[model samples]
Target chain A: MPHLDILKAAASSNQWMAIYPELLLGSLALVLLALEIILPKKQHAVIPSVAIIGQIGVLIWLAFNFHTVFLKPEHAYTFSGLLHHSEVGQFMRVFFLLASILVCVLGTIALAKQKMPRIEFFHIVLVVSAAMMLLAQSNNFILLFVALETVTVGFYILVSYFRTNPLSLEAGLKYLIMGALSSGLLLFGIVLLYGVAGNPTLPGSSANPMDFTALHTFLLANPNNFLASIGIVLVLSGVAFKIGAVPFQIWIPDVYQGAPTPVTAFLAVASKAAGFSLLLILTQNVFTPYEKLTTPVLAIMAAATILFGNLAALTQHNVKRLIGLSGVSHAGYLLIGVVAAGSQPLAIGAIYFYLFAYLLASFAVFGVMTHVAGGDDADQDLAHYSDLAKTHPFLGAVLAIGLGSLAGIPPLAGFMGKLLIFVAAFKAGLHVLLVVAIVGVVISIYYYFGWIKAAFFETWRAPLLEGETDLRPMCTPVGIMAGVALAMLALATVVLGCYQGAFGDWLLALKF
Target chain B: MADLIFYIFAAFTAGSALAVVLTKNTVAAALALLLCLVGVAGIFVLLDAFLLAALMVFVYAGAVVALFLFIVMLLDVQGGVRKPFKKATIVSSVFAFILLLLGLASFAHKGVQTTGDLGAAAPVGATLKSYGEQLFTTYLLPVQIVGFLLLIAMLGVIVLSKKFEGLEDIK
Candidate 1:
């Protein structure tokens, strides 16, 4: 009866408030699309500004609504349980908003150096960001599938934004094929789960099986169902692909290297964040009953992902490919947090903290890379970065600190993040995984420092031609904005590393 | 009579699906896919899901097939070349056969009940109306989200396919 009333009430316009952020962002995307059509080409520069401002406005709106949503976690289900409002969802929304703003800024800087359809880029990114936010809040399979596809479709274009680059086009095609395949797998999994859950006889029945709570109940009731196990495993594999885990890690390096640097940064941070959020939701809510079946599979994937990602990265000469491979390892570490969920009560918080730290450090490094590459793919070779410290000391320092943090140097955010993950793994009695993670970290330092060495100590190798000057980094406003973004991220990395307690306490307060 | 119609549609669906895979020319394959979609739509009609049947025809057979043909023509890829099957093809066929067997086995050994409550059985007209009502009410969020997904896809197409000044130079 209570659920029926919720369904009835959800049909009213009042339910609109539950999804105001998505609505606002969607409208903003449409508005940008209209502007793109109406505005003269010369005024295309204004589109990114509009996207950034609109995102900030949504962030402010989310902040104002946060307390109201946070206070009544019990009443968080809205749109008849399509969306869930929780502290974690709120945190993810903020994370996605901040990431979107940074991406928009980064994309603007990158677009300044290359001529393409700039307005559409901002709109598509905004749409994808909005979709990701919805994904974090999704409480049902239908929303999950749609949101995931929205993000994937948007990324297919963003990755190949530079169609002129054969590499970019190839990456886009590879991503499209793989992404479509994963989507098929995910849908098939959902169908299998749906069939097992049985079709709902009554509208909005507590037995409406796609609903998370209902699905949880069904799974608990029928834990030993073979079809359910297959369904869950299929779903997990699809998500693992999205997160760029091993065996599914084939596309990461190529896509990351081939995409425009800013888009690469977006994929690295926001796209991965969305995938991890969905994984968090699935593992925490849906698959909790089947932990025994899933845990071992996840552990093996984690170990393989860490080993392969780190070992392969050691030989990569392209900066984007290196970061992409290392990103796979980070996914492995994050999987550790996921595996520890049942055993460690604070594991979710640890995952959040780790993602937060990773976001800052990775974004800082990507921002510097975007600045140095200046929208050109040819400049991405590691050798091109040699002796950067001699000419651009500040840029060199940023790269050094960013890579150092990624390598888990002490007194940086990444170290604290790794420490939190390791502690959680230990508390969960995952000694083997903890050891493998440590080994992965040690292996990672070699290549991370290789980039650092190139940036700092290595002398410029190619002899200078007569009167040929090195290509000076662009000093445009977009370039300055990228620098500022990197500096702020670097500062946040250092501050978070130093004062871990504050963030830790805040995250711990977030009820899963 | 209904059983006869179901068998006919099923046969056509299977045949067209195989043709879709076996056809060497892209355009012919697309046409085979269209027939397969129509056959599936006919099967939906037999299942009493008239709305779904109609959508299968309109969306998949009509819109999607047309789009595929458009792309095939636009790319001008008219059976340019065909390569002989290689060792990789044999390996892939073996894997595909294994997967097909596994799927068949899983479906055959259904210990758990596959068909659950599918709502009160009603007349086809009422069922279609109720389906529309539920779509507009119960599943409104997903509908809106799908709308956004389509919009994003449209934007992606424009950005990737549209030729602009200086694009050729970069290529």
Candidate 2:
């Protein structure tokens, strides 16, 4: 009877409390829709400003009330989700919300500056951010499917926001087709899991729900269960496709190159961050019983993705495509933290911290790339960056900082992220992975600097750059984002390497 | 008597499912899928899930397939069938054969356990009352939230498909 009362109270309050993030974003989505409709076409800049402010408000709201409500044990924790919150959930939620807010700011100016339909772009982004918020909290496969598809539908539109651009349209179509296929695979996995655990007539335990906790217990009890193994494998495969895990990573570079630059940045950073966050939740919580297969599978995939992403990027001259591949390689390293799955405070903290680092570095790099090769950004080729140091020194320096950090050069956020991950991997006794990471970091140095060298070292016979080209400040948001990224990078270089103990412990204490 | 009813529906279910894959015209394939779904509903009835069986027929077969047909009409699927089966017939048959082998293996290994007594434990309506009670009490949050999300998804589809509130709230 008390359980009944507790359940009822939970159900009542969960409407406002458990799903606070989604509810907040839901309100934001509604406001955006209303504003998009009511606002005059010429004054569309107001729409993005409204959304940016609103999204930031949600982020602050999430941060301020973080551990008090969301971290509280009672109301927020309900349902059989693929993930639930601990300190890891809070960390991911805070960072993901922050990234999404940054993206909203970036998207506002980016689409407007490109002379695209600015209002609809903001609408889709807000709705998708809401879905992403739910995705980070999902502990059940059903919620996973629903949340992932919500985000995909938004991406399909956002990718083709430049409807007049054929490449954008093609990227949209490819994304839709391949995205639907991956969703199908994920659905199949969820349904098979349902088949395994949901049948009330399954004899021994008639208490099968899609709840992650019970499901984990059942799988652990029957560790050799073939059905459980198959379900977990398929789910992981679905997640791998989400994070651009190799063998399922074929669609990424095309999708990244073909979409609008801002959309690509979102896809590369926040979108991928959401994917990793979900992966952490699913593997660590739902499939904990089947860790044996999950670990080896992730290790093999991490190795393959890192190797393939790096190798493929070496040949790419297109700046966007190169960064796209770089995102894939970074996903591989994040998998090390995943493979090092234990109840360790430091390991999980490292993963979340690395995500924060990667997000800023990526945003800064791609933010600069919008004007990388041209003032008009005509060619977007590597050769265009030759003598960039002489022409657009600030842009070149910002790019170098972003790329250098990404390549894990010491004194940047990427290096700290990588170092933390390596330490975590070593602590987890992943000797081979630590070695591979070392070698991979070295390989990364060459490719990343190769671009840097072209930007600064090589001299071109071209005449003096035009004022419009050189003085645009890499478009409007580039300087601001560079500031954000550099500040973050500085933290990675100086603070994280030195003073991360308390912050890391606090991050580890987060509950989703 | 229930066993006979189950087997009859199961055969129809299997046959229609096969036809859905084998049919030539796209529309005909969709119709075959509808038939397959109906047969599945019949099997659900045999299992004594009165509400669920109704849902299988009304929601899945009626709504989902209808939506599929709506989309199929917009996209051309049957253009240039030119020698569709001649080259691939042998390969597809081999593939089908391998699938058959696997199907046989799965059923043989598992050895079907009769769910006959499961139905005897409770009648549909009586058990459903308890389920409803639990759903409203214990499983209430997921039920409500999924319902809300679905509402949002439906609203989204409407907003995208019917462009209202664009020009002074047009559409």
Candidate 3:
């Protein structure tokens, strides 16, 4: 009877205000659709600006009120324990919002070039980002799966938004299949964990086993349970697919190459960050008791992921594939941070810092790629950038800075990010992983510089046959909006690298 | 009698699942998947999870399999000729098979652990009213999120399939 009373009370007092940001985003998405229907054809161009400005408004509002609810010293359980809000969750909420704003900006630039229905793309992006915000804070399996699905399904559409290109459609199909398989694996793991945790005979068994705290208690009591270990591995495998670790990275190159540049960037940055966030929560909180098993598994995965990602990128001709593979190596480095977080509290901060650095650097590069890309978005190659610096010095500089940051060159945000992770790993005694990561970074530099070299220096080739003009698609001119966005990204990357400002200080001070 | 039914349904589900994978005809594979789902539903019924059984039949066996069949027939897929496995494919598949067998053997040997009898505990999803109450209360956020998921899925189908005309090259 008390349980019934509790349920009734929870139902009646579902505090909707705690998720005001998510609500605002979902409403903005709907408003875009409504505007698309009501407005005249010529006025539809204004809809994307509305979406972007509305998101910026939400971001500002969130920033102003960041400490209002869960910035307290402890975590707050809202939505009847479906959401666990903490400082990390708040940080990720802001991170996802910032990422989506950049995506919409890129979307506007990319969509303008293609003959596509533009409003739905922005709408889906808004909804997906909102879901990602929820996903970063989810405390229960049901909510986690639901929010993850929303993001994945939205990506399915965004990947194929450029449907005229066969490659885009192929990427969408591959993503759909791979996504479904990962979902199934994750669900299987969740079900197994639930069943085992709810067993009446088990010590510390929970009635509500899907709740992370309840499951954590059960896992704590049964540290060496066989079924729990299986579930843990399966869940990690599912997340591995999202972050593009070694064995699960087969779809990354193809999908990235085929997706429109903005969508590819979204996948490379936002989607991977979301995966790492989830992995961090699950490993550090729910399955922490099984570190005996998880540590070795993650260590092996990190080593292999770093090695494979670097080695594979060495031979790729396509720029998208190169970025995608390099993104895999980035995920590997973050995985090392996750492993280090088990012992070193600083690793969590390092992971967040790394993700932010990655976001700024990646958006800069992809922004440049978007302007440089022609009608056929999937056909960008290094050869197309033979004389990029000569033609567009502005874009070429942004590209260099972005690639430099990604390669962990000094005086860039990415270097500080990598240094933080390596320090965390060294403190945690993950010496072997640190060595592999350093080697990966060294290998990574060759390819990253190859891309830089492609832009800044022309490779000598046989003279073009008479009358065979260059067949490469003409690079689109950068708009004022895109130019400003790229400049902001490059500037932020440089600034964050040079100074551990208040933002960096706050991130480093965060605890799990 | 209940034990007999459980064994029968398990066999039926396993056999049909194998058929779904091995069958060459696309339509036959779809039908086999339906049977496999029905078998799962029957097993759920045996476990006193009537609500789950009903939902499985209604959702997966009823709607999803039907959609699969419709798409299969509408496309008039010849099921495509199967290509011979390459040397690498064969080697990798064999390796995977061995790994799978090892996993199954370990699971069979050590996966099951004894638990106290469950006769006293209330089954969470055994009835409709309680399930609805749970969905509206503690699980409300997930339900709303699922709403968005379905909405986007519907929008995805439309945006991906719809044809546009006289589109300008914006470049």
Candidate 4:
């Protein structure tokens, strides 16, 4: 029968080996759950270590096998065209793994203080990381939606893991509502595009329009199609919510302040990176025909995001909220790189470098926040950080370096990251956005410096009454694992800054 | 006949959807939502998407609405007094309203350009067999990934709700 033959052919193309990392991660997640059930209570502490080490193993294996299919002249369509694997996809897989390992490291410290289920947090992180890997390489919209939903649903539970905290619960509820709304918008856009592109009368329309290449061909044939343009804009808007761009950034501060610190870092770094990688793929490849519509929308959002993020971060005493808003500004800067990627190839590498810089600096800063945070996870404040350097020099130094890099200070990785993007933006003749980004960088320095000053230099305050006790949460002493992670992050930040080396060249030289 | 049925179901869905939003009583609103889903299923049937229509009715109208009713009844949630809109809310809503108008106007003007003859090629999700075959074959990866999604979601529910009898040990 033709049908049986067709099924056999399609089934034969399901290459499970191409996604070994994701498969290994999913298996590891299940193993963690099984171990939790089997191991006695005292031995449960080893579970987080397993998650971290297993992820590192995956990362090592990935690195060793990097050139197995790296920079192939053509993209590899695996799993029957559901995934389009390229060198960029490989890079993102590595990025997500690194981010997950750090989050797990921070999760141990953060979870130690909380009276919550610890094993589940690690399980969710692994599954979410695996999902993000698939999301980055999704060739079909079905896989994209499925992978994205897995990540988002994992976050909903992870966000509210500390259910004892009312703030955490509130953040979870807000995220659920807002996330559902964004997904609705994205689904509407996808349905619209799918409907429009499958119309047989349309030039270059495809039988399978959900595939990115198929949709790209349809879009190329109908560059000015109205429904297609609307769909593109709506999809971009949904992604904007994930990256915390202006107008879609209302949920950031509350969610950040209320979420446990490590999860906040995950949202700030990994989730944002996932969105940008998908955005890069979408705009650079699938949506290229709609550049006329996308470029202006992105440019405007970038400008607004930069101004809003910096301005809002000012006047925030809550350190988590402050970092969260600053992250918004970083998203703005990345948006500039994304817009410029249309005209400048260097912008792609610049964007990835910036994300790597962000991952390192953000995890460094958040690792410190995890140590500084006390029992009430939601109430971390800038005042609590006063005299931090005098008390704990290591954390204070890490904080200063992280913040300085974030502020684009020279000889720091963030400085190099920002410089590369600015150069690309200049080459793209986005002079207006370039100016907006500069002003944003200057404004961001003020708040970042404010944080640094709070840590390093003590400001005068009224003496406490005899009955009043100090409310500041005492900084937790660094553990061996956390210390190593933070030190590695800080060193990487400094080293990558001084020398981009062959790594930078490889990233710049990547095909889309 | 099909066009008439499509219009009727479409109207029914839209009207009940509006009721679901506007109604003050929680149970009444939920019932309206059920009607909305049924109407959507009806429209799906008119469009020759029998499997989707049945699944919509079965999964959403059957299971989900029942779950909603159980929760609503168990909580006995009263419709509290509505707060007045804040300045930001009002301003943003107004801006959103204008944008919606512009979007609707543009869609009305230009969305109808695609007047394609419906092709003989069968739609992917039109039947249970084809859907199952596709799910187990070409779309196997997504299906497996979705399994993980549900697994985590289940774990999340337990993590979020399970009472900690051994809190000390957990810590």
TM-score of each candidate's B chain against the true B chain? 0.77, 0.68, 0.92, 0.92
Candidate achieving higher lDDT, 2 or 4: 4
Task: Give the per-residue lDDT digits (tens) of candidate 3, residues A401-428.
Answer: 9999999999999999999999999999
Per-model lDDT: 0.84, 0.71, 0.92, 0.93
Stretches > 4 Å off in candidate 4: A1-4, A70-75, A464-468, B84-95
Question: What DockQ does every candidate get?
Answer: 0.47, 0.21, 0.66, 0.81
Q: Which pairs clash in model 3?
A: none
TM-score of 4: 0.98
| Predicted complex 4: CAPRI docking category | high
RMSD of each: 3.6, 4.9, 1.9, 1.5
Local error of candidate 2 at residue A430 (angstroms): 2.1
CAPRI-wise, candidate 1 is: acceptable
Q: Give the TM-score of each candidate.
A: 0.92, 0.84, 0.97, 0.98
lDDT of 1 by residue, B72-157 (tens): 98998867576778999989999999999987787678734635534463442336666666677778888888888888788788
**Residue A210: error of model 2 in Å?**
1.1
lDDT of 2 by residue, B38-129 (tens): 99988877766777788788898999999989888879677345555666888999999999899668746763433445545544243566
Worst 10 residues of 2 chain A by lDDT: A371-380
lDDT of 3 at A244: 94
Q: What is the DockQ score of candidate 2, to 2 decimals? A: 0.21
The candidate, 1 or 2, that scores higher on TM-score is: 1
As for DockQ, the candidate ahead, 2 or 3, is 3
Q: How many backbone clashes does candidate 1 have?
A: 0
Q: Give per-candidate clash totals.
A: 0, 15, 0, 0
